[model samples]
Target chain A: MSYGFVAPYTALVIAFGVLPALYAVFLAFTDNEGGFAGIANFTKVVSDFRFLPAVAHVALYLVIWLVALVVLVSFLAVVVHAVRVRWLSRTLRFVFYLPGALAGASSVLLWLFVLDPTASPVSGLLHLLGFSSFVQVIVPANLPPVFAIIAFWTGAGGWIVIMYGALNNISPDVIEAARIDGATAVQIARRIQLPMLRKWISYMGIMSLAAGTQLFVEPQLLSQASNAIVPNDYSLNQLAYQYAFQQNDFNGAAAISLLLLVIALALSAVFVTRGGLFEKD
Target chain B: MTTVDVGRPARRRNPARRRNSVSGWSMRTIIAVVVAIFVLFFVIPIVWLLLATTKSAHALIVDNPFQPGSFGDLAANWDQLFGFQDGAVTSWVGNSALYALGALVITLVASIPAGYAMALTEFRFRRLLLVLTLIVMLIPNTALVLPIFLELNVVGLIGSPLSVILPMAFFPFGVYLTYIYFNTSVPRDLLAAARLDGCTEFQVFTRVALPLAAPIVALVAFFSFVQNWNNFFLPFVMLPSSEGYPIQVGLTSLLASTPAFNPSSAGAQSVQLPTLALATVISVLPVLIVFLFAQRFLVAGMTAGGTKE
Candidate 1:
């Protein structure tokens, strides 16, 4: 009876995560060329011209992204914490979060305008900086930061709200003592407040790290705008998609997808352990 | 006290002085500027999208692109969007409803049980299951698209709604949510008592835990629905027919003909931009309405079952 109670979910997890994972690993080995060709496909994936570039794409994006997120979101959380402007802050957070409310495909379409050169609101700023062509505004080398701008635009505001919620959890008494000790608001915040929010920071970092590596939509949209100069397959997953759909090599697609899975798994492991996801928070 | 600790005290003092010098105004102003910069970065594109729908395709390309053109052709645009390629876009909306709703049901049924099982029972391989679920949660949405598409193709469900729906139902986040609910909220002692009173295990779950789990169930349903509703990649690949495209995919296919994000996509019949924005607006309304009503539950759901019940 207990077994029956648990069976369906167990089956579902195995069906979705576990079995798919095993098959993905299997896919990393076999190839259309020789059928179960062993390390040949894995080697090709490693040596593919786009392989390191794709990793570089996400890495540069992640650095800018992680720094921007930590600084901006923390600032948003702290200010909202200080002002006690309850309704206004909540409404502002929601407005900021609205971009995320637009699904990725929609948001990408919207972002093209921000990145567009002529007659766009951003045109003046880009002109001031001497980037006249929209293509110049986002050369192949600059695509990472451009997408980071777009991804952060759509996603980061909600994170501010999440961090603020964690900030609320800090005990008022500890805050009061820091205040009574003649600590400046900055001192109180750095010493007493931000320290307490470390768990949320760690959680946010890991989640961002995991999500950052698999960057897609912005690149996909970029490819659409850039006349194939930006290979839609600039990200690993995009590479997988092109391989499967355009190239029709399910096995190669699976191999790349599996590599992505391993990266995600390893990151999750680090997070679940270091982030203390289920521990006392 | 005058003979303060040598190294540590000096380090603390330096940081404190710097921090104190950083007044709230500068911080607020700078942060606000940073946020405004991001806001403009995000807002411009959406505003451009809004303006795009107001023009004819010719005007959209030839005229001042950013300026909103006359609404003289709004009706004509709408007619083309709805009637273009023989009402193909409207069919996409119907298909989306069918797939999202189907996925929502499966997500609820599958996730609740999975969450419950992980939370309540001390089963073997449970720790591994927990770890694996976290991993699945992190896999980018589009990463598995190809593999799943291929699998469905081999099994011959590629063009059917089942390709999307079956995959969507297997919601890892929902499972984690349910597990958290069980772990934190459901009192173990109550379950033991129910068992002692001759209540079957199934009875204990349904009678006690299920009622309180409503918020999470609703959360899972909302998430699954919105994901399927907004999804582009899965339907783009798996469904061969336009009849199976979701609203997002349909909107995108419509937008492809227009430059970048222009609403006036070129077809046998010309369409305009505002209709596309209107279509975008229409596609988003259902999710927004659901979200506005359901957001109160989100905070509770995210925090719930994961920590103190």
Candidate 2:
């Protein structure tokens, strides 16, 4: 029976997880430039045009996504803990998490309408201010940030909900004791409550890190509204995509994906071992 | 595993002086302002989606937006969406449901038993097995997309629904969740007592542990279902044929192909923006409905392992 239970999980991991991971890594080392050229694929991936920009795009996205989630979740969590309005707090948490349920493609589509100058109400306001064309509202340089805004709209809520749940882990008496010590609300939170929740915050950060690196869905969809102007090889995942899907270069795609995997694994290992990602300190 | 740490509240302090402080008022004002801005950002997209779907492709851009509700235009636009490409979107939705439901069933069967075995049995390599699961979880799902596709291609299962569904079924998150839930939530002493009563291990698990695993059963079901249902990338890659496309992919393909489907502003990209908007609106309805029913279970069940018990 134990073997029976293990059978399905084992088969799946081997067929879909372990085998693929090993095969992809091996593929990355090969030069399947139309056919096999052995180790040339890895060399090409490292030296490819737009490689640095791809890395930079992911780096920039990570910085913005992590900062936004940390700042927003912590702030909202602090406010909820201070106010203690049960129903209102629950409602707000619901509103924040609802966006997460929407898929990335859907969120991107939603933003396209909101950003459309001719139809958007804000664009109407912009028109009244003599800014008619979308070019007035957004330019090429600011486009990635606009995509990041769409991501935050859909993701920041789930983190805030996580923070709320984490805050509940803090004992009520502790907050009261800090109050008795004449510590201000800000002082109590920063000095007392915040320290207690560091492990959770770390886990969220690490999880966010893994998520931020996989920035394919947003950029892919956004490129449509932006008229494919977001640069086809803008991010590593997108570059891999354009290679495999657009150019039919599966070897190059596998190569870049392996690089992404290494980066993700390194970050996740740090959290898993020391940041209390799955256990209490 | 029951912590039962109900620390009492600190003693009362005077309240009259607290209400008059400027810091309190200003902080409240700041919070209110932030809430207003953030909530508006959240609300606008959904409202725009709803409103955009209600208007015809032409009226969406040409008209002065946000007029009173047009039940007529919504019905008409939906009729066109389904009838647009001979109702392909409906087939896509059906395909998505089949894949998500298939994966969800397999995830439950595989993960629940794995969780139970990991928690209860004194099996060899338990620690090694646990570490393996953790490492697997760390390996980002997207990074493995290429390798999985290759594996499927080698086995010639690329276009099959099983290609996507089989992969989605191995949810490490679900396994880890069950591990933690079983570790903390269940009464291990009850199992020991059942053994003392001459009950076999399987009987103890089936009779006592399984029934009490209610909350987690629901939690895993919801997460597994949602992840599979909302998944776009794997299906997009595996199912080369549009016939096997899920709703999310179907919607995206429709959005991508919309400019040709409609001739509005053939010269400009902005003209077809509402097509994308309508696709977004239709994609979220199922998840939203499922979430409303399952959210309470999600919150309570999540509190166990996710927050370190």
- The numbered model that scores best in lDDT is 2
Note the residue pairs that clash in candidate 2: none
The pairs that clash in candidate 1 are B53-B273, B53-B274, B115-B179, B180-B305
TM-score of each: 0.86, 0.89
| Native-to-model Cα distance after best TM-score fit, residue A274 in candidate 2, in Å | 1.0
Separately for all candidates shown, the number of backbone clashes (residues 3 or more apart, or on different chains) is 4, 0
Q: Give the TM-score of candidate 1.
A: 0.86
List, residue by residue over B145-202, the lDDT tens digit for candidate 1: 6667655666788787788888777777777777776777788898888889998778
Instruction: Please give, for residues A15-70, the per-residue lDDT of candidate 2 as tens digits.
Output: 77678888887777765544566777778877987888778777877787778777
Considering every candidate listed, which one attains the maximal TM-score? 2
Native-to-model Cα distance after best TM-score fit, residue A249 in candidate 2, in Å = 3.3
Q: Stretches of candidate 1 above 4 Å error?
A: A33-36, A117-123, A131-133, A279-281, B1-76, B122-127, B196-198, B260-271, B305-309
TM-score of model number 1, chain B: 0.78
lDDT score at residue B60, model 1, on the 0-100 scale: 55
